[model samples]
Target: MSSTPTTFDVRADFPILSQTVHGTPLVYLDSGATSQKPQVVLDAEVDFLTRANSAVHRGAHTLAGEATELFEDARATVSGFLGARPEQLVWTSGATFALNLVAYAIGNATAGRGPSRFALAPGDEIVVTETEHHANLIPWQELAARTGAVLRSIPVRDDGTLDTDAAASLIGERTRVVAFTHVSNVLGIVNPVAELVALARTAGALTVLDACQSAPHLPFDFDALGVDLAAFSGHKMLGPYGVGGLLGRSDVLDDLPPFLTGGSMVTTVTLDEAHFLAAPQKFEAGTQPVSQAIGLAAAARYLEGLGMDAVHDRERTLERRMMAGLREIEGVRILGDASGVERVGIASFDVEGVHAHDVGQFLDDRGVAVRVGHHCAKPLHARFGLTASVRASTSVFTTDDEIDVFLDALAGVRPFFGVGA
Candidate 1:
C-alpha cells in the first residue's frame, strides 16, 4: 500500500456519472443543490433495511436493538465529522428543519416556556446577512415577527463579501441572535465566521451558523468555530436525503424548549402536563430516519478516509479553474468576488443579456447539469440587480474534463440566444 493518503476518483465511485444525457455524456455540475450518492452510501442504507430494519430507541426486539445501535453510531460519526459531541447533535429532516428548529424553539422560550437565554422580547434585534439563503433568512424573519424583535442585516459589499464594518455596527448590545451563513450558496464566498462569532459573543448574543455549504467543502470544527448553534444537510455532503444535523451548545439546547413534541421525546405525560427529555431527544420527536442516518454515517466514514484537507484542496483547485475559464467567456459575468476571493467550488453568474433559465436549458441540451435562478436566495439576487442567475458547483468527484465541457457549453449560450457579442 502507498504511504500517501488515497485520493478519490471522480468518475469510478459514482454510477450516475457514467450515464448519458441527450445522447451525450453527462457532466454533472449542480452539486450545490444536491450531490450524487456513492455506491457505498447506497449500500449502507440497503444493508440496514435488508437486515436490521426497525424503530430505533423505542422498541425491545432484536431488530430494534440493532437499529438503535446503528442510529446512535451514526450520531457519533456525524458529530465527529463536525467536531461536536454525539449528544450535541439533533436529527432533523434537513438544514431547513434544523434552522426552523432553532428559531421556533427560541420562540417557544420567548413565549415563557424556558430560561431567558434563548428568549427574545420587543426591542431585541436579530441580525442576518443580505447574502443569506432563505433557509437562514426566513426563519429569523418569522422569529422576529413572533417575538416582537427587530430584524437587521449585514450589508453585502460590491464583491459579494460581507461588510464586517457594517456587521460591527448592526450587531450591538440589543442583538439577541446573530445568524449567518458560513458560505453563500450563491456567491460561493466564505464568510468571516470567527469574526462574526466573536462579535456576537462580545454582544452577549447567540450565534447561529448556516453550515450547509461549508460542511461539505471545508474542514469544519463546530466547537472550535465557537458558534452557539449550527445546521447542515446530509444530502449536500453525498449522504442520503431526508437527514441532516443541528448542533448546539448543550447549555443553549437545555435553555430552549422542544420545537416538535410528541412520542419518544418526553419523560412523562399527563392529560394536562408533560415532561420532556434532554437536549437532543427532546428535539427529536416521532420516528426518525433510521436508514438515512446509517447511510450518512457511511458517507462520513468515506469522507474521513479521503481526509477533509485533501477534499478541500481538490475542490478549491477545481473552483479556481472554473472561475478562470468562465472569466474568459464573453458576456459571462461571474457573480460575487470574482477576483479569486476565498470560496468553495461554487460559481453563480449571469450572462450579458440572456435569462438564466435559457442558459440552463442550453447547458442541459449539451449534457451539462447546473442550477439556475435565485437558488432560494432572492435578496442576494436583487442586490446583483437581477432576478436569477446560473450556478455550477463542484464536488470531490468533479473532473477537469467536466469543467472544460461546462465552460465550452457556457461560451455558446449567449450566441445561441442571440445576445450581444
Candidate 2:
C-alpha cells in the first residue's frame, strides 16, 4: 500500500484506457472478463489484413505463402511464450473451444474412435474442482453424460483453497481425467498445479488445465507445470478476440482424435472415409482465425518485452493494496481468504444487503468498470452462500490510483443504497 512507484508504467500502450466514461477517466478493473487491447495488437491484425490476407496452407500464391508463414510463425511465438513447441499448439476460437475440443475428443475415444488410453467406461470418473468456471465445468459434465462416466469435484475449503486431501481421495483408480483451473477466476487463488498433477499422474489420469486466468498474470510455462494439456484465451491476455490455443504434450496430442473434422485438417477424404493429419493440424479445421492469431502473437511479444516476472510483481503489489483497502470497509465481505495465499490482482466481494448489479451500476456511473455476477463461476458463488458478487481484476496497465478510485467508490456503496448507514 506504500506509494512506491509501480514496476510497470505502460498504461499508455492501451488506447482504450485513455478514454472517458461518464465524464471521468476510465478505470478498467474487469480484466478477468477481457483485457483491453493495446495499440500493437490492433496494428498487428490490421497489418496482416492489409498486406498478407490469404488462405493459409491452401495455395501456392505469394500472399498465401506469406500468410501461411506468418500464421505458423504466430503459432511458434505463442507456443514459445508458454514453454511449448509450435507442433504442440492447436488454434481455437477461444479457451471455451479449446476445452470442448479436449472433452469431445475424449468422448470420441470413449466411443471407440481413438487410442484406448482416452476411452472412458461407465462408472469412470472425471474430476474437477468446485471453483471451476462453467467453461471448464460444463464441458466435462456433458462429456460424462455422453460417456456414462461419473463427474466428481474437489471441494473448496472455507478459505477458498482447494482441499488437496479431497483431491487425493477423489482421484483414484477410477479417475480418467483430472481437470482444474490454474487460477480461480472468482477468488483469484493460484491453485497448486504441481501437487495436483503429481496426484493425477499417480492415478494414471490425464491432467487438463484451465489457464485462462493464469497465463496472463503468472510466469506461465505449461511444460514446466507438467499438465498433460492446457487451454488459454487471447482476449484475456491483451490480445484480440476470437482466438486462443490448446497446448499439450506431443504424445498426448498425437493420441487424441480430432474433435472437429473437415477441410484443412484432412490428408485424404473419400466419399465414405477420411484420414486426418497430425496433432495440431488435425484439430484445426476449416479457415483459422488468421488476423486474430497474428494479433495474439504480437500480444505475446509485448508481454515478453515487459517480462512476466515483473508483471507478476507489479500485480501482487496492486492486489495487496486492493485487498487491504477492501477489508477496512464495513459491510464488505471478500469472497475468499485473502490472507497468506498467492493470488493475482483480483478481489471479489459482497456488500451486505446490496445486490451486486446495483453496486456495478454505482461504480459504472463513476467510470470505475468492474465485473459483477457469478463470473461464469456459479458453483463457486454457491459455495460462498451467495448468487453473485462484484469482482475487480487488474492487468499490467492498471494503476494504483485506479485501485484507490475503485476502493473509494466502493466505500460508499452501502451508504448510497441506504443500508448499513
Candidate 3:
C-alpha cells in the first residue's frame, strides 16, 4: 500500500470489501456505524484462542501465565493508542457500558461510597449538548434522576454546529458534570473540545468526552485533550465487537467506586464484608473480553502503522469530494453546514419526496451500503426537523472510487422514484 497523505491503498487489508452484492462490487459507506475488521485483527483473535485459551490471572499454570501476559499487553497497546497509561484504562462491553459505568460509579459516590467531590446534590446541573448520541445523553439523564441533579443541554445552531456561547452560560457554578461527543455521528462535525474543557475547568465541573468517532479517524490523546474521562468502542475502529474502553485520570479512577462488583476484583473478603481492588480492576468484574482485547490491540497497531495523520488527510480529501458531489445534486439537502469547519468523511442528507428508508434501499440495490435512520440520535434529528436521514461514512479502507460510486448511486435516487428535480 502507498504511504501518501492523499491516497490510501489499504483497502486490500479488509477482505469483506472484495465481495459482490446484488451482482455489483460492494461499496460500504457506513463506517460510522461500525468498521470492517482487517485480516490481521481476525488472525490475532484466532491465534490467541488457539494458543493461549486459559483464564487470565487465575491458576499458576503456564497457559494462565501466557494468557495473563497477552491480556495485559493488549491493555498496554490500547492505552498507548490513546496516549494513556495502562492503569488508567478499564475494559467494558462497549461505549454504552463504559458511559454507564462512569454514571453509576458517580451515583455510588453520591450514596456515600466514595469521595464527596463526585457526589451530586440537589439543584446540581449535568450539562450535555444537543448533538450527543443517546449513549452519552441517557446515562446522564438517569444519573440526574437518581441524584437530585438537574439535566440541561446546550442547543445547536441551524447549521448543526454547537452554540458555544450558550454552552459557556450553561456550564457555570451549578454544573457538576459536562458530557459531550467529540464528533457528531449525524453531522460528522468535530466539536470544540478545548473550549468546552476550559469552560468546565473554570466552573470546577468534570468533563466527560465521547471519543467513539474520533478514535478511529484522528490522532487521539486523552492526556492532551485534558478530559477527566473518555469512552470509545473497538468495533468502530476496525476491531471486534463486545469490547470497549473507558479512560480516566489516575486520581479520578482512584476516587471512583466500583460499578460492578464480584470475583476478580476483590482484595480480601469476609462472610459479611469485602475489600475491593484498585481502579480498572475494581470496575472490571467477572470474566473479561480476552480474545476481543487482543484483536483490538492488533487493530490499533494496524492504524499506527498506517499513520493517523495520513489517514486523516486521505479522509479529508474524500470528504471534500463527497460534499462537493452532494451539493451539485438537486433536491439533496445535507444535514450540516460544511463551510469552514473541520469534519470527518461523513455526510447525512435527505432526498426530496422520498423516505429515508427508500433512499437507503435504492443505494443498497446498487451495492452501496449506508445508514438510514435517526442513528440513535433522535434529538439531533428532531433539531433539524427530520426523523431520519441517509448517512455515508468513510474509513481507512474507503477509496476514492468507492466515494464516486456512492455519489453516483445517490444522484439516481430522485430519478428512480419519479421525483422531478
Candidate 4:
C-alpha cells in the first residue's frame, strides 16, 4: 500500500464476503448493480433503528426531533456528495423512482398541469442516447408519446459510443428535453456530459442526467456538471436497497409538481385548492426512508472518508486490468472501449458461442459473480447487435487478487463450452 491510507483491505470489512460461495472463496464484481455494505454503513443503520427510530419533518417529540435532524443531516450529506444545496435534494424510493418522478412531473407539465416552465407540447422532441438505461429512456418515451412529441435518440457508434456530431445535429430547436446517462451501466462508457449539456443548452432544452453509475465511484457536482437534474441510488453507493435521491437546481425542482403526494407535502388544503411546501419537502411527501436515508448518509460519509478521487483512481486501475484481461480471451468481445475516454470500473462483454446466462453460471460455479443480461438497456443491446452480455463491475474494495481469480475462472469458461482455440 502507498503512504496514503486510501488502500482498501478486502477482508477487513464486508461480513458477507468473508463467507464461502458454493464452497469456494467469493469474488464479487457486480458493483454496477449494487455495492457491498461496509461495516460502517451497516452499523449506522443498526444504530438508528435501535435508538433514534421515529418519523421525520412533522413531529415535536424528542425521538421525532432526533429523527428529523438525522434525516435532514442525511440530506445534507448527500447534497455535499453532489455539491448541491441540501434543500435541493429530494428523497425517493430508489433510482427508478427518482427517474419516474421526473418523468411523471415532466409529463404533468406537458399536459399543462405542472408549472408553466415545463410545458412541453406537440411537435416538441425529447432526445436520449441509445446507450441510456431504460430508467433514462422509457420514461421519456412515455412522456413523448403522451405529449405527441417526437422521441429521438443519439445513435451509438460501432464501439458503443454516441456520435456527438450526430447528437449536435439531432438536438434541434424542437428538442424540448434531453436526458442521458453519465455512465453506461452495461458498457462502462462515460458519456461526454459537458458537451451534451452545452448542446442541450443551445437547443433550449432541459437536461436530465442519470448519474446512477457515476455517483457511486466518481466525483460529482450536479451544478458544475451543468445538469438541470441528476438521479442516483443509495444501494449502489454501499447503502441499503430502498433509498435514492434526485438532485436538481432549486428553481427547476420548485417548478415540478410532486409525483407521490399524500400527507406531509401540503401547506394549506381546501376542497378544490391545495398548496404544497417548498422544493425538497414538497417532493418528499409521505414518511421518508428514515433508516435508509441515514444509512445512505453514513455510506456517503464512508465514501467521503475514503475520498472520491482515491476511489476513482483505484477503480480505474482495476477497470483497465479487467478490460485488458477480458480482451485477451479469444472469443470474448467487450461492448464499448470508449476510445480512451475516462470511465469507471464497469465492463460488459460477450462470448462468441455462449449464452450470457451460461457464461454467468459458469463464472458463478467458480465463485465469481457477475451480471448477465441486457442490463435494462435493451435498446443498447440492440444497438450493438447483442441480446445479452456478461458484465463485470468493481468498486473500491475490489482487490487485484479477486480479479485474478475472476480471470482464472473466466479462462476455463470457453473450454468448458467448447468454444475456444
Best by lDDT: 2
Q: Report every candidate's CA lDDT.
A: 0.92, 0.95, 0.94, 0.88
Provide the TM-score for each candidate, comma-separated: 0.97, 0.98, 0.98, 0.97
The weakest ten consecutive residues by lDDT in model 4 span 1-10
In model 3, residue pairs whose N, Cα or C atoms come closer than 3 Å (at least 3 residues apart or on different chains), thus clashing, are none
Candidate 2 structure quality by residue, lDDT tens digits, 12-76: 89989999999999999999999999899999999999999999999999999999999999999
Tens-digit lDDT track of model 3 for 250-289 = 9999999999999999999999998999988989899999
Model 1 backbone overlap count: 0
Runs of candidate 2 exceeding 4 Å displacement: 1-6
> Which is superior by lDDT, 1 or 3?
3
lDDT score, candidate 2: 0.95
**Model 3 CA lDDT for position 329:** 90
Better TM-score candidate (3, 4): 3
**Candidate 1 C-alpha lDDT tens digits along 188-226:** 999999899989999999999999999998999999999
Q: Can you rank all candidates by lDDT, best first?
A: 2, 3, 1, 4
The C-alpha RMSD in Å for every predicted model, in order, reads 2.1, 1.5, 1.6, 1.7
* Count of steric clashes across candidates, in order: 0, 0, 0, 0
